[model samples]
Target: MSVTPARTGARPARWPTGVGRLVAGAALLTAVALLPWLSGTDPALTVLRALSADQDPTPAQLAAVREQLGLDEGPFSHLVHWLGGLPRGDAGTSWVSGEPVLPQVASAFAVSLTLMLGALAVTVAVAALVSARTLYLGSRRRLHRVRAGTGAAVLAALPKFLLASLLATVCGVWLDWFPSSGWEGPQSMVLPALALGVPSGAVIGGLLDQALPAAFNEPWARTWCAYGFPSGLTARNALRRTLAGVLPQLLPTVVALVGGAVAVEKIFNIPGLGRLALDAAMAQDLPPLQTATLFLVLLGVTAGRLLQALRHALLGPALRDGALATLHQPALPRRRSPRRVAALCAAALLTLVVAGLLRDPLHVDTAARLMPPSAAHPLGTDSLGRDLLARLGHGALRTAGVALAVTAVSAAAGLLVGLTARVGAGLTEVASTLPAVLAGLLTTAVTGPSVWGAACAVCLVAWTPYAAQAAALLEEERASGHLLASVSFGAGPRYLLRHHLLPAVLPALLRNALLRLPTTVLVLASLGFLGLGEQPPTPEWGRLLSENQPYGELAPWTVLAPAGALVLLSVLAVSATPSGRSGTRRSGAAS
Candidate 1:
């Protein structure tokens, strides 16, 4: 039997060294640092062509174009151009609108980013509130619990865009309280921020429902309670346990922030990277496309990596001891029952239904646009006369598709990278720690904001931290007695991993992914909203909300439908998760 290790305030066990790891890490980081340059290569080539052009046709012209674009310059010159300092504005003009691409994109990027970040702050704040409420309700009277539960469910069920629309109509228009759209500054951001935040709040609130229960059941909770501690005190300590679980859930939320910003910015006309990327993609401008994608990709990677760092910083010693204990502890038996399976299935199905129902179902037809909720139009029409319901569906499908894909692809990729470190390979090490800051830029370059392009970019960069985590955890496991004993019995790596390691790691993987799923959906929606994904008239959730801003007061449902779907999906995801939630007070407190 495995006995728990006596832990100290020492650094945690980490993965071993390997050259491959270094190379991979170097590749990603180097890519980040040099992405703008590498991505700018083709665009520079075009510039060179324009500069060297004498006649419509000339071999010398091609040569001059190459020379001017720095093709004639040595590798060092190319490198110099690639890393070439700050671009306050563009070196090229917009092929589509004849605008100076750089300034337009730069300003737009600022606006969009402001919207995304502002909304993120609001969402995080609201989620924190909801989580607190869930914790507060846990030990409250039955009546209060019931009320909180119903309210939580309702809040979670409404989609983000839907909530945004309602607020736009009532608070924004009817009340004449807030701006319906156009992010002129912080003041104009009020409605969109609320819309973006409501869904996040719902999701976090629901997670608290699960986490609070689990915390109250942990050994710590029991220990505290047995000591005659006040219920409030016990609950607070238990909350620490719950907070541990919450770590895994936070990563996805950051990803979702990027996506949400895309949508909110578009509606508010807030310029940000997402908006720039979107415009670049639509116009097929390769430079900005790659640059923007690289930014997002870096953001995804950096988010995961930072979260990993925090985990180690906060829980490394505890996790080490817990791992050692878990290794020796007898496997917890699974309860085999039809009821459990049925319940889980029902829960999942119900959530899926909510996501579907809340989808924007808009169809593009100017004649049918922007009608209020009425008999002639079920949910009402948009300014373009499109069926808002169909548009909502389209948005939901796109957002859901991206989230699912990003989670699956990124998680799997992370796992593959992580396992390589078990054998002490160095190559995995460097790659695992890569700080690829230019992910968004590279993504823009590669796919130019095409949905597939953005998804691929996210996958490539997003998986890095997960890989780092899995690798580090396994490294600790490899050093333990359990591994030694299994190896002594002639156990192969594959066998041990499949039978023992996978079981231990599976829960963490699932929990992390649970949070990521909704985040991915929201992120994609935001990107599309920023004009990064899908062509015009596709009516994605973010885009729909953005288009209807002018009429946010007159008929807000158009935006609400899609936004509400996003919020509901996020909430359902959080609720269904096994853990991750807010702090809660315990049963007894000093009265």
Candidate 2:
């Protein structure tokens, strides 16, 4: 079945489409190819270091290396030479390995592809089970859906590295059920796949749970039920409709899985494309890094095209006849105060942070190393015999503090740009597609790994969501009857901005920022786990998890302590966020 814009009442997108998209993709690749030059790193030195770390090469040797790698021709000249070979399927040669880039990248891509496929399977299974359980609960479906959504949020908030460390510790080391840190066989993939898939599955399942109820409430569903159709058949049809609507999200979800696999692959020691990219970035190997990034970008584009086709096929008649209804207005539950819940979570986290601050995080005691919980060190000790409680407390200050700073910056910038600009829809869509991890890689490539780089990386994409939401809120306010009436009364732009738009937008924007706090922390922590955030000996949460992962089997408390802290932070963030719609209306009305 073919779908057309006219039949569906779809407005033409202002963003690049058709051949424009191809040009945009090429421009992005070109920008990535020029990163080494952009960062002002010497290509000859980089190649020499990667090729032979021990060598202190003289000027003669440096010139020879530069000539060999085409660095002598300049970045743009080399880019032209590389692009010229693309039609022949050549991606140049790796500076480090001296092998063709395509073969190395292709081999890594195969591993990553297999891991992604396995993760996809797990995501589908999880989403199906959660969705089915929510639908089958009969009278309690709404309540069950809320609880399930909360659970999913907590699960989805977990950073992949933390989860991987936990899984490896519990399932791999303690139980001996699977290999924790290698790519020996299928069993080795299990922990990594589960670590990657479970969060994504929770996200998809929560979306499905939200969409299914709305679909079941549609007039078509009621008619089927009234026509003596089997309840099961009607339910199945409703599910199909829900899936059709949810299919568009598949592109972002798949892309996220691929991006998230970076930390997961590193933790599990899987030689996937993500790991290759990380290695290449660290070694400053431009050829392999450029090739790996290009392949990843193509993978995302390919997945988007396939998912769009599937959406069209599933939409079929609905698209042609304009029968598909908007799914945004889901059946919502009664709003209740989450302040008490938030307060309780905050108290717990605060207590941990306060108690931890009293102890010394850096003092090493070899005799007390790896000790279980005791009176002196309540949370136990790490491999260095440093108190876990102290480390966790100090780490909390850094993790939560940095996350809060990033969230504030993102929210403010997003609000400012979104309110002033008419181009949010296109810009937001494009910006949202670029993952924070990818941004972090680029930032690290330029500035080297540091907390500042991680913050910059997260800030790069974190603001897009807020901008999208703010722009939407602004548009809604402009169309509201009250706003039009005010304008008719000669209300000026500043008057409307102060009285209507700001009142309506700020509350919702604040809520969005609060809700995003956990994710910011997770991203920062993920960077730390991957050695891109704070360096070791600093006691950052992600670094703590990585440092203690090896001893998870020997002393579970070391890993559990920090992991538990992150979980508490997520719970606090979610609980603190008020309901967006009701809060917005109330605030707007009050103003």
Candidate 1: regions farther than 4 A off: 1-77, 81-124, 137-209, 248-262, 265-317, 320-367, 372-377, 382-406, 415-458, 461-501, 504-518, 526-532, 535-552, 563-591
Residue 428 in model 1: lDDT = 32
Quickly count the clashes in candidate 2: 0
lDDT per residue (tens digit) for residues 1-591 in model 1: 543333321123344443453445445544543443455554434443444432344566556545544444443553334335336433444433445545665565465456667766876676666666545644331212322233344465444554565676678678888777666667787787677666666555545444465445444445555676666775565455445434434544555545324444455455566556545544334445444544544455565556556655544454444343323322211212234433554565455445446654434567666777676555677787866655665556666666678888888887776676533234433332222222444676656767776566556556743554455445444544455456556677578788656654555555456554655554454445444455576656555655675576667676566555555554455445443212221111111
TM-score of 1: 0.61
Lowest summed lDDT window (length 10), candidate 2: 582-591
What ranges in model 2 sit over 4 Å off? 1-15, 138-148, 166-188, 210-247, 312-331, 335-343, 405-438, 445-449, 461-519, 529-531, 580-591
Instruction: Give the per-residue lDDT digits (tens) of candidate 2, residues 429-542.
Output: 344445566678778877888998999989977886577556545644454445555555677777878887887677656655654566677778777766778888898776
* Global lDDT of model 1: 0.51
Candidate 2: C-alpha lDDT? 0.68
